[model samples]
Target: MGSIDPPPIKLPSIKLDTTLAELYKRASPKTAGLRLGLASCGVTSAVDLTPDFQRNSRYPYQDQALIKVPRRQLTLDNTNLRKSIAKKYLSLIPQRDAFIAGAMPVILFNLGQSPKQIEHDRREAETTISVLDCAQRPDLIFCPGPIKIPLQPEQDHGHGIDKLDYKVVLDGLEANQDRLTRDLETHWFLNSKAALARSGLPTPRSEILETEGVPPEDPESCCRVCAAAASSSSSPGSAAELPLFPAKCTGPRGRWLAAQKDRILSAARARPVPFVFKTQQAFGGAGTWLVRTAEQKSALLAELAGDDSDNDDDDGVLGKLLAQVTSSNAHLGPATVLLSELVGADGDGKTVVGDYGLTFVVTDRDDEADGGAAHFLAASEQNTDGSNAWIGSTISYPRQEQLRRKFEGLMRQTAAWLARYGYIGPVGVDVLEVKKSGSGQGETEFFIVDLNARISGSMSLPLLRGHFVGRGLTCASSVSIVAKGGRAGFIQRWRKPFEEGRMLILSWYEDPEAGESIAEVVIGGENEERLQELVQRVRENIEEVTL
Candidate 1:
């Protein structure tokens, strides 16, 4: 990182009343037990999900395109993975048995699915609860499985009225309204704005598609505008552009994409270096593409001539390129695309191999309303594919005291800003560190690239922190691996690191016949230095191939 400072923030001009909303507190003498209902993968800015809410949105004001919030939806498979990971977390709670009986059960309101799909969700939930094996038995009132609803028709699947689908979701939610509200005291924590909308209550609001000046709630429009502004202001020493939040743009998809390209290409011409392309709605680094030369850009433009393939993972660079290839294609529209010059830390004239992030929790408690507080959880050095994808995180603990000091005020301000927009829950701000060159002393610059307003892939860090704190140890890092080729005793075969107490396997999901698997590991040590050592050892011992 270069000279240390908080990246510049562009505050929205639209002001609102600062009186804070009250959140459901834990059960107590004066308060009823908070029956928290969970809404997984609610309606997002992207069109892959239902467009009922978007259909009702008041957008595209005066030809100024409204950029909707970015979509971070997970697949049904990842849904199971999340539950499995959460099981390990539930096990980490030392007092799980004591609290289970009295703890209010959480209802996982999921996207509507078919009868068969509903069965799968029910089986997964049952397995999750059974695996926990708590003594008292929490009243985890999940349900008769995820409610089934009709999926939104693809852009090309239908034309006139047949294209609608959100109405089905709304109908389903309305049908279950009475059951959902059987317990008047239930508090709902939703994953998408659409879910919150369907609830018809305003206690917890989502600022996602409701950002000021972004009236349309259209993902393509919102993504392109905000991305263009971010790209222009992302130079090394310039004041950083506003954090990647909603902003407005105008015209159709082609114009928007061209504008973004010109902005990014202008920067490349100025610097003559590689740049990264990003789409707002993709996951697992799937929406990222690296453009190295003008010829490559030309070739990409040429390939767009007749490519109409719409199947396969649209979350990666290939999908993003295809979207661009057919920008005008009604089937694939242009939204949520952005570009930025690749910058990294340079130590002793050499690029270092890491980035850091400050992860914290934001809640809707009344006590914090006086002036929102940044409940600083832990800072972690992020592990990724050298781009936008987040792989894992290692808790840096008290070791980042210096960086922490620089970040304290920034964190508080950011949290407060988010709260102003009605977001209440987990928030992570990713910071990029670029070490100064030839300074002959330690000096670094920091930049904020992304803000995850919801749960992140690295959620395991906070859970690991709780466990380590209870054990009087600090967690070093959490690592995620996608590997192939393992045996029946794969865990045992990888015992050297575990035997050395360098790391512990948290969870693993594999396909034996296909010989492929994915897993997450938690590493630990007494302090930061020791933690780094443990991380290296774990990495060396765990081969990318064969478990």
Candidate 2:
């Protein structure tokens, strides 16, 4: 089996003026200054930095500046100018210690380079930062998103900056974005038909097309169907059918309506027994269902019909399904409907293995963020195809030694690949872990599944924590998700259990101090007994925490 390495250990140094120095002198010696990227994307995405600043603002030194560089204009000249302006702003802020660059991917991608070219630009960009001042260099440089590179030691050795020290914030579900995208390119699955060809992985067979009229209802109506089905089945095809994974129909509503329905029905019938039905555009598990029998399918159809009545819609079941497929419309484009085969559990009760979502951050620094350091945040776990059950999660602050090595290796591989495409910054990779059947221990396998090209919720926690701490920080605790809404009431009702650690729930939305909106439950400390107590409390009051 291939081995995964942990990240390296390195921390950015914060420069402090008299006031900040005095403050640090009085506090823990381990405390370090942290610069936050308070850009709009960072703030709305909940990249936490407020707490950290609050805790450290009183330090002997502090620097503040709003660095605004256009996303579309990341030329070397613009980058240098931004850096110069940032330096000037720092000069004015009192007791400033260190610098943290916090530009996001939205801005980065707008630079208009492919994934591959982005790497060369990034290296050049980092070089610019390095040469700015020999006397006082920025201690840490963090991206608002995950770095789209694998972690590799040999390859990273000569870089002027410590790659490990640079951090990419990520959401929990999308940690492996970089790896998946790399795999996609490596495997050549960028478009729909290409994705279908690579079906050995967990992706659905699908297709993509541009049409002026509505989609065709007959299977043979479109050429994509002929191509997709031609390989697997000998059956004669129809014009409306297309062979693809997550098949998409794009055009005016009327032209595609009938064809889209036929495609959805065909997908439903063709799916294996005990499958799931999901609308393409839904998020956070919405518009997803498990269908074991025709009865359940009918029930779902009835529900869709009911929904249609409220809006005076004519499409009924098909329409609801189509709406779900197009929910991510703004981002994906207009009038597009996607239908994918549902992947489910195997007979052994293990969900069909889909892919693992590995969330990690890449920092410009060559070292890992300190233990319990909240400077970088990420969420990731293995996603199975069948049950959709997640296994092997690493949500809390990473053990620097354990995480860095793995991240570095992965980043090195990913970066090298992306360097060819002009894509840089934070990425989320969806991976599939396939295990051999029988022997109760067949060799386990890993494959890339999908990719998310932005900052994720997994990274938000650490950011928030760091903002609270006002230093480069990481958390040694795990944050558990609970139902949204009424979280405050739930926490208030179960405060005792939480304090006692009987319920080791970390409220993601709860202001640790104010205790509002307990979106997540947190559990910490080295005490096993305390952990257990929290677990029991969670078991007892789960209903309160869940919607």
Candidate 3:
């Protein structure tokens, strides 16, 4: 895509604070070309394209993580997920970006969409305020078309990866000669659960699961549940007579997969909430599902057992899982997924589970000194809405010390693992502190739940929290809200704090006709009390206008 003529809009006067400036310098010691405009990797990353892979999983059932599915569904789901990111989340990228433009001083994004649709979203975002880099006011670039550069000297226009699919964003950037070698390092390892298993860090019992349709010797052999094993030799998985799962393999491999699935299904039946299925390269909490109830387990297991005669009618967790599978008759395999223990819930393991986001910066340096080398920026507790989706984050630099100590060893190990791959950028690891479920909740367990190699979704929380890195005002909060207010009304309502520099607007996406906007904002305060009070007042003010 080509850069659009930036509409003439009022620019915010961004006064760079020395402390905040230090973070930017540290994040990009050599270059200030932090790219936020790259096309994003959505819900799923890889399509198996072939049969079941040789497993590197720790658990037996992990070998069955990849199953054959229809291809038509896979392409459609991929298209929809990418479109949603380009349309909705594209506007929210600049909130933490404008406030903390240190790491990403320049934003580059190619929506690869119709220019009209691209401009439509940009206008709704109030781009000046939404993409405003209050720290440096970074140069903005938006091209809604594919790269014209010589990516593949061998391939023509529509065939180049840049034009074929912008799904893998970095490939397009590198084609333009941006030195992003560090970003490419170890991305595959860090992208999946394999990195965590290999890191030897604290994590839940995780396994890579894969499923083969049937034994090549007996493609017609149907699993007891498969009503269509003999439907067509084109898809043996549809009618494979496998146990515990809808798939089947006749020999030793089949038995191994059966045993694995059996153990997992047994444990799932024994416990209320026992498993979480994590899709590869999924972002913004889109592909994480908690199997918490016996009912949910029953429904999910039934789907796994080849109960697809209903035409994918179920709108539950299993249905979502099917979306990534090959849904067409040709090439019916699903993308590889991860199955892990669902640590802490009510009966379903939703008890006192403390979810934390620990963000740190990795620089290319061989420090033979004391404290772990990577910069552990902020340890923010994630805030989730009623649906348990991440809504915001409450980060505190001063408070992060205790968390660092508690998970110090774990963090160091993680940082070392990332550094080993020559990766030097922002990395965030999600952690969970679980209080024992039964027997008075006396015991505790800590598990590293997620590893984000690149700049994570909530990574901007640090830019706002970094304001008080050394100073005493350490408490920081950032949240996204859908409030009823027109552009003028919304800004005027918070003008006092806006002018006073007490509260910072991260993003504002206006829905003019609906009289509402979804905003992501952060505020710095002297203490947690003041932070809470200010947030309440902001909410009250916004709520008052809503009525």
RMSD values for the candidates in order, in angstroms, are 16.9, 18.9, 9.9
Task: Write the number of the candidate with greater TM-score, choosing between 2 and 3.
Answer: 3
Q: Number of clashing residue pairs in every model?
A: 15, 142, 39
Give the least accurate 10-residue stretch of model 3, judged by summed lDDT. 54-63
Residue 173 in model 3: lDDT = 46
Best by lDDT: 3
The residue-by-residue lDDT of candidate 3 on 349-380, one tens digit each, is 54555778887766655454424547666688
Query: TM-score of each candidate?
Result: 0.50, 0.42, 0.64
lDDT of 1 at 193: 22
Q: lDDT values of the candidates? A: 0.38, 0.32, 0.49
lDDT of 1 at 505: 49
Worst 10 residues of 1 by lDDT: 56-65
Residue 272 of model 1 has an lDDT of 36
Candidate with best TM-score:
3
lDDT tens readout by residue for model 1, 1-547 = 6987534322111111110111223111122232333323222212212212221011100000111111122222233423332222212111121122222233333222457644544443443234222432334332222333221234212211111111012223443454342221111122222332233321112212111111222334555664565565455443221122321344443344444444433443443335454443333333444557667554433322212223221122222222222212222222323445445412224343346677655544435432235655556776765433445677755565566676676677666655555555555666665555665676765555555554454454544443455445665677755455542244455555454444554444344444654456667777777777866665665532110
Ranking by lDDT: 3, 1, 2
